[model samples]
Target: MQSKNQLVELPLFAEKQVTLVLKREDLLHPFISGNKYRKLKYNLLEANNSGHGTILTFGGAFSNHIEATSFAAKEKGFKSIGIIRGEELVDSWHKNTTLLKAHEDGMKFKFVSRDDYRRKEDSDFLADLTKEFGEFYLVPEGGTNTLAIKGCEEIITEDDKQFNFICSSVGTGGTVSGLINSSFPHQEVLGFSSLKGDFLKKDIDKLTNNIRWNLISDYHFGGYAKISQELIHFINEFKKYTNIPLDPIYTGKMMFGLFDMVRRDTFAKGTKVLAIHTGGLQGIAGMNSVLKKKKLPLLDI
Candidate 1:
């Protein structure tokens, strides 16, 4: 399903004379929304065509991938198994909103320690999972695989050709890689990573040889799944003004970076920028719970 692109209006836009539009990929589904839908679409078909009866993937407490994969697997008539990263969550997984939603959608969980989770790519670990789950199609953590990139490529269409720049929040690099591959020659693709470091550039390079893309390494705001009071305030204020809700992990950081760049005149005057709102809104409730426990201000969505 193609989502409508809404133009974002801000005082800064007029003052800077730059046009900003938000590609509402978040509206793709109430549950399996945004880049998650794009990433999983073809992967699901591939799994079914390959005669797989179960889908196995990896994630953490509030991983959007795990939740989206669960619903997608159920809708496709395939069973799903989520290899959760934290072993301590095994007892309380049902209490966590994200995991609970996945469970409600018929996902089974295999909780592992953080140390053990790091070995997910090892042959022996994967072999053990295959033996236990009985021959399942494996989706890598964060849902970035060859098939996933193929699906994400469809996010940008001919209609998006008018824009000079295409921006998105980079996680596993699949969505941004797809954007890079599909971008027009005149359009530059900028990916704002939601994690710390410049390592994602190498992974995206492995996927596509395109030289039209650049990775922005300074906007992570810590690392994956890490949030701050400032980010929470920005997200809330942004929603209040634009009616567009941004999750703390990805889109929020992306928009923050994009706007900051605009203030610094990163783009020339009259430049049209299209920012992809890859959805992770489902995890907001789970994140709010964490904030509540820590006595931090909750997201005002």
Candidate 2:
């Protein structure tokens, strides 16, 4: 589905002489929202077509992918398995809102050690999972694959071609790659990296040959899932002003970076920018729990 592009009336845009429109992909669904919905679209169809009765995927404690996959699988009549990254979560998974929600959606969890989780794509590791789970369709960590990219490509439509720049949060790179593949040659795609590294550039390059893209490594706020009072403050204030909630993991960071660029006068005076709000808001409750423990300010729900 094509998400609405809402113009942001922030004073910063007027001051910078740049037009900023946010693509409300977050409104795509309450559970399977944003890029997650797009990423899983074709993957689920392929799994059903192949006659798989179960879907298995990988994620960390508060991964949006895990929660989205669980809901999507349940909706499609497929049992779901989430190979969680930390074995410690085995005992405390219920304390995590994301995991608990996934469990409530009928997803079974297999908490493994971080070391073991790293081998998720290894043939031997996958073979062992297949042996244990009895046959299941494997969706890669972050749900980024060929079919997922195909689904993400549909996020951009003819209506979006007017923007000179398209911005999105970079996770496993599938969403950004799809944006790059589908964007017009005249438009530049800027991927704000949620993870701290230039490695995503290489991974994204492998997925698409489009050169009209640049990976912005700043604004990760320490790394994936990591946030600070400053970022939380920005998120809350942005919501207060725009009524658009951004998750700390992905969309929040992307919007933060995009706004920073505007302040720095990165875009030309008349340049139009479209930022993708890839939903990960389900993780806010989980993040708020951590913030509470840290004695930090909580994000406004």
Candidate 3:
């Protein structure tokens, strides 16, 4: 039996001859959704098969990865540990927050200095973490691994609809890289960088063996977790047309860039595009929460 929900087909807006179709992978699960689920599937299974009692990973305060891994590991009967970035905020121990929810549900966490987390490239640094966790299976930050990429590739194959172009927002580049690897011939895949200083093409190349693709860097607004009024206005406008709300973190920037590119005539006449909605939509909860306080007009989607 399938454990998750059905894929959501979110509509797109096209001007001139180009058409867009969004594969809403966000709605795949309620507790922990999107590509996070796909990536963790094999990782958790392997951890269990190896007889590891604990799963260790890393992420930030709003990390979909840490949240997903925590719940998934819980369901799969493994202990979860998140090496969080920075000091825990005051009142942050409560599980109402997603990260804290992980902790509440038996996911253990340890806070580390940002400077120390930045040293992840150092083997000595990882050795320290591994020693602290004690024989845990380590999932990289963002749940990225070769096996994870393979699982995401299956998502690309699920849709047979022919598309001239594909795009998605990139955090660690796992989903976008997998989409490129599994895309049908003649389909060009593009990734929108969600963070500043992120070299997604380079990062994907490191995880992907021989998967060719494109990375569009112009759409991030102001890197990860940043937005502007223009973005808000566009998000509202997009929902007016498509009845789907794009969270500012990922899909919102993607649609913004896609539309801008269309206006700039980057896409030729009659082009068809497929944008994967790799969801981290809990960002919307925080977003809409803030908007409610400001009493801004909400998009009715």
Candidate 4:
């Protein structure tokens, strides 16, 4: 039941004399949407082909990847294990809607300290996990893998070629890599990083030969999972104006960056811009809780 999400033009962009359309990839699924869906599409198939009954992945407290993977595995009839970072969450993790929803979806969580979580890619660590959780298909954190990039390659279609710039929010670089691979030579792919770092450039370069893409490293307000009142206000205002609910973690930041670029006249007057709305809307409630704790404006989802 996968349908094409609409590409709606933003009136704000019209004011700037620029054509900006949001590819509503968020409409793909209530749970699994946008890049999460793209990333997991082939990974799950590979897991099933490998004869594994369970899928084990890693993520943090409010990871959209964890939430999406949990629901996706449930929908696809695969048992899921989320190796969650921050061992302290073991006691009252239910306070977070993301983890609670995953738990409800039958995703067992293995809580570990932040330091221990860093060893996720180590062979010995993975071997120990296989012994502890039994033989399972391991998906890297954020669901970025070779299969993931393959799935993401499908995000663009023949219809998207009209746009000169293809933009997406980058997490683990899989989505941008896919976009880069599929982009036409006449088009440029721009990735706005949600995390603060230049580290993703090498990771993205490893996946594609297309030099038509560039990473925008300055948009991350603070760092990963870190938010400010300015970002919260922008998310709220954006929802009110466009009725497009953007998750603060990914799409919100991406949109904020896109709007900033538009305001600065980053692109030519007649340029067409397509911003991919990579879904993470499910995490809004959890984010709202944190915002409420900090006495900040919550996303008007």
Comparing 1 and 4 on TM-score, the stronger one: 1
lDDT of 3 by residue, 170-234 (tens): 88988888877888777778888888875777888887664457788888888887777788899
Least lDDT summed over 10 consecutive residues: which range in candidate 4?
1-10
Please report the candidate that would top lDDT against the real structure.
2
What are the Cα lDDT values of the candidates? Answer: 0.94, 0.94, 0.76, 0.88
Q: For residues 1-301, could you state the per-residue lDDT of candidate 4 as single tens digits?
A: 2436454456667888888788888889889988899899999999889898999999988889999999999999999999999989999999888899999999999999988999999999999999998999988999998999998889888888889999998999999999999988799999999898799999999999999988997789888878888898888887776678888888888888988998898988888888888898888888888888888777776
RMSD of each: 0.8, 0.7, 3.3, 1.4
Instruction: TM-score each candidate.
Output: 0.98, 0.99, 0.87, 0.96
Candidate 1's residue-wise lDDT over 160-245, tens digit each?
A: 99999999999999999999999999999999999898899999999998999899998898998889998899899999999899
Assess the local accuracy of residue 163 in candidate 3 as a C-alpha lDDT between 0 and 100: 72
- Backbone clashes under 3 angstroms, per model: 0, 0, 0, 0
Model 3 misplaced regions, further than 4 Å: 1-14, 88-96, 209-212, 287-301
Q: Would you list the clashing residue pairs of candidate 3?
A: none
Per-residue lDDT of candidate 2, residues 102-168 (tens digit)? 9999999999999999999899999999899899999999999999999999999999989999999
